[model samples]
Target: MTEHQDAQGQHAPTTPPAEPAVKSAGPSPEMLELAGRMFDAARTGDVDTLEAYIVAGLNPDLQNGKGDTFLTLAAYHDQPAVVEMLIRVGADVEKANDRGQRPLTCATFKGDAASMRLLLAAGADPDAGTPSARQTAQMFGGERVAAVLDEAR
Candidate 1:
């Protein structure tokens, strides 16, 4: 055991007490609720709420456990305005989810021409991700999307 001098010049043992093991409690209810609201805002095209959350320090590119970012959910849900808002707030256009699906690919898969155009205009990579936005458009027979992709390049 080690000893330390006290203010009165007396020596005292410096041994510390043992600490108890602690368990993690994961995210708080408030945090989960906020996350739910954020995801809801993205899927429902609630640009006002989404923008407010982002302005209040929520990440524009915030992703869920499935690796889907706010932009990804908005694009997949055909929410062009929400996608635009996320993009304007600095969300990544080419961020791929755990499934390797980018926002452009999600828009193309859903045959949402407006969202696809929005993503493309924001510099989304047409040839990125697993199937790639171009391949998804071709698979879905989105000739309009293919045309948009061609025009973007």
Candidate 2:
């Protein structure tokens, strides 16, 4: 089929998208994605993979989109081995997520007694962060977990 054209036989001019005025000084998207997977490893108890990354120089304190550190996710998900490995490597147990939820609080929220005990033994402050572990347990009816938190205080 024949198409009509301008009498001048000229194509329309278009401008390409403009680049940002300044270069980003943050980690590249690829690096961020890899870090996210490491956080997932912590949550899912992929101990071997997670340990390998940490040994390979991945920051043990890597935070997810919600600012949840390795310890927070591992404890919240009830991954005892992962939590122990993280504690051994010196990951901060007190780092709260964006919502101000700490690893201990997460454990209590999930009623994970094992993680609560582990975190408490590792020196996690039971009273840190908003809705502290004790408060979370009491608020959520985590009687058993509450008992563990009480012992830590």
Candidate 3:
């Protein structure tokens, strides 16, 4: 317990030295590969692969760097089953991307009536985010989509 002396020769209580900072191991190669595969599954509407990953503890609402969630990708790709599965697993129905586009809006823009219906059934807000699903349907001249949106309202 040696005393520490100040510049003025005043005795000061010694303090314990700080431990060295530990470096993070970061994501392993396997983790990186798995993440890539998961994103691919979402984009390609591979429901089984996505389901397996989710069951293995991957977040159902995992987003890419652009903030596009798995649900958003599935909806944009016109995959109603994948959208339904994601919604069933508790994915956010109103999660907006960086551009403020929701899954419902993406489905409407793509004229995917089935996906639009699925999103609406899962309680998605037709008016959520910029350029809402209703607005998108109107812009895309999807009369069926507009009718569904009206019915859901």
Candidate 4:
């Protein structure tokens, strides 16, 4: 019997070596470009690029230099669907920009009923402000937003 053999035993089957786990690649220049693209897409309400980026794992609440998030830009531009999408993706609806204007307040000042409705439904505070949403709406003569303010009481 060979030294490799045990009593009445055939050669032991060798265990296969374990494979190491591979990690996903880190962010590259291309990813940075993709983030910038998503930010612009939100500004224009470009649904295709926005959806594509979201599906590809870009965060919906990404902000620009002015601290304006995607949702903020969508509200500012009166893009209701984009606003809804951002809200659905957990964007901070009440986040203030560099000017200290909330998304809802900006929507109110611009007199966008659709955006206002979306923001209100997302629990944005109509009465919460330095220049509050209610006051901004009143200043801009936004009857719909003013009505919203009244209902919040």
Candidate 5:
């Protein structure tokens, strides 16, 4: 037995007791309500309502449960006009969702050349890293998107 052994000859290990798990502080009620309204606005393509909400101090970069921004939702739902509006209101076009898909990637994946054009013209980075909008366009066989991105290079 070591010199630090108990009288009974068993070595005693010294360590502090661990702390109990603490409760996580989730989103507030107001943030939740605002996020729901933002989702509805994006889904319904209600530009007026969305503008009002943004003007009233709602975040333009608000995301849903899937970590999809309003711009991503607008693009996925084929609401090009709403996408434009959100971009004008300062939405992050290059923002990725949980799947690492940006708004441009969603539009390109859907083969919506017009939407892709708009986003590209707005300075959305086509060369963003892996699973990028440009790569998604190529993967989805969007010849027009590839041509356009190539031209931009």
Candidate 6:
């Protein structure tokens, strides 16, 4: 046993008891709620709110439970402003979800030619994910987007 000075500066035979280690309980409710809001922003084209969150240290690449990212939701909903903002803020354009779907696939599936073009311009892989953007376009009647993807190649 080592002697230590106490509060009164007197030598004591024992040291103060060590603090207990704090156990993690994972993300708090507030954080989960905030994440839900951010996902909603992405899905609803709330570019201002999403931008604010991203600016306030929120990771733009944070994926949801099933691995779908902000960019995926934005592209899926044809939110041009949100997509552009996510791309400019370093979101992964080629990231695939748990279901092996990418942002480009979402845009292609909906035949959102504008979104497909934007994603392609941002380096989104047309051939990425389980159903490649090309395959998705073909399967979903997105001939226009398919043509755009071809042109991008």
Q: Pick the candidate with the highest lDDT.
A: 6
Model 5: lDDT to the true structure: 0.79
Better of 1 and 2 by lDDT: 1
Cα-lDDT of candidate 1 = 0.89
Kindly list the per-residue Cα lDDT of model 2 for residues 71-110, writing each as its tens digit: 8999889898998898888899898899999999998898
Candidate RMSDs in Å, in order, are: 5.2, 7.9, 3.2, 9.1, 5.9, 6.2
Stretches > 4 Å off in candidate 6: 1-20
Q: What is candidate 5's lDDT per residue for 1-153, written digit by digit as tens? A: 223578898878755656668766799899788788878788778888988889889888877888898888887777888888888888888888887888888877776666677788888888773577788877884677688666656
- The residue-by-residue lDDT of candidate 6 on 11-39, one tens digit each, is 98986778779978899999999999999
Query: How much is the lDDT of residue 127 in candidate 1?
Result: 93
**Which pairs, if any, clash in model 2?**
none
lDDT, residue 72, candidate 4: 79
Per-residue CA lDDT of model 1 for 95-151, tens digit only, reads 999999999999888878888888888888899999899998889846777887887
| Model 2 superposed RMSD (Cα) | 7.9
Pairs in steric clash, model 6: none
What local distance difference test score does each model get? 0.89, 0.86, 0.87, 0.79, 0.79, 0.90
User: What lDDT would candidate 3 get against the real structure?
Assistant: 0.87
Predicted candidate 3: what Cα RMSD to the true structure? 3.2
Q: lDDT for model 4, please.
A: 0.79
**Between candidates 2 and 4, the TM-score winner:** 2
TM for candidate 3 is 0.84
- Deviation of model 3 at 4, angstroms: 9.2
- Indicate the residue-level lDDT of 4 in model 4: 53
| lDDT, residue 123, model 3 | 90
Of 2 and 3, which scores higher on TM-score? 3
